[model samples]
Target: MSSSELVRVGIQIICEHLIEVLKEELKRSRKNYREDVDVGGLDPLEDPESYRNHLRMSENQFEELYEKVKSKIEKQNTIMREALPSRLKLQITLRYLATGDTYGTLEALYRVPRCSIGRFVPEVCKAIWEVLEEYIKVSRTNLLNNIYLVHSLT
Candidate 1:
């Protein structure tokens, strides 16, 4: 495949992997919230030790987390459409690929399937890099003024 196409596929693989990690992270965070936040029962001050709360959120914190998650997700979607971009999935995927996050740990940040990530990343890598080589090599050598570099060196 062409380098750009390959790169796009590669990018997609990374994005897919990142999506998987994100999905997992999101799931894990929900679980933590379920366990720790303890929606509606008794205050910790009131009851120190039982399976106390059942509510997923307190009115305030719930509102806050909800907004943050919603905002982040929306931002991600918005970034996808933009021409100049953050490359959201790639960033997160890089984090995982670079950081070696456990699936469970990754589950907290991304609500994605690890299997899907594992399965497709190779394809994405292949697609993107192959195309990428051509894309990068197909350079337009328009000579810009070298005065900026010349001055800086002097």
Candidate 2:
């Protein structure tokens, strides 16, 4: 083979080796930094009273709400990692709403990254609102109708 051809082949091999080394380094870095905190195992249902205090609602109420909104908020797992469970998403959102805690506080408590918590909280809240909006509207309508009737009688 020509010297130029041999030199090109050598450069290509070096580039491939560097790429593999970079990939391995990335995997090692991710392993070192990833907080593999098992947030799933921390089930609030185990202590109902504490759960209620934390989220400002009973476990049964939380389950009912989860049933209604699960379809909207639940996500499928991807190859890189398992998706955060729908129940966890709801709990995080509720805790944030109940306590007005910052995402950093939540990250420490829940072992979720602050960025993930911030991204998912709004989405979970929207799902909850969508599920509950009909009940809210109906309740408001009934309240207004009762008020009008009482005013007319007076």
Best by lDDT: 2
The deviation in Å at residue 119 for candidate 2 is 2.0
lDDT of 1: 0.41
For model 1 the TM-score comes to 0.25
lDDT (Cα, 0-100) at 27 in candidate 1: 68
Each model's TM-score, in the order given?
A: 0.25, 0.66
Clashes of each: 31, 0
**Which tens-of-lDDT digit does each residue in 57-99 have in candidate 2?**
9878988999999999889865446688888888888887787
Candidate 2, TM-score vs. the true structure? 0.66
Off by over 4 Å in 2: 17-37, 40-42, 79-81, 137-154
Deviation in Å, model 2, residue 14 alpha carbon: 3.8
lDDT per residue (tens digit) for residues 7-53 in model 1: 99999999999999999987677555534421112333554332122
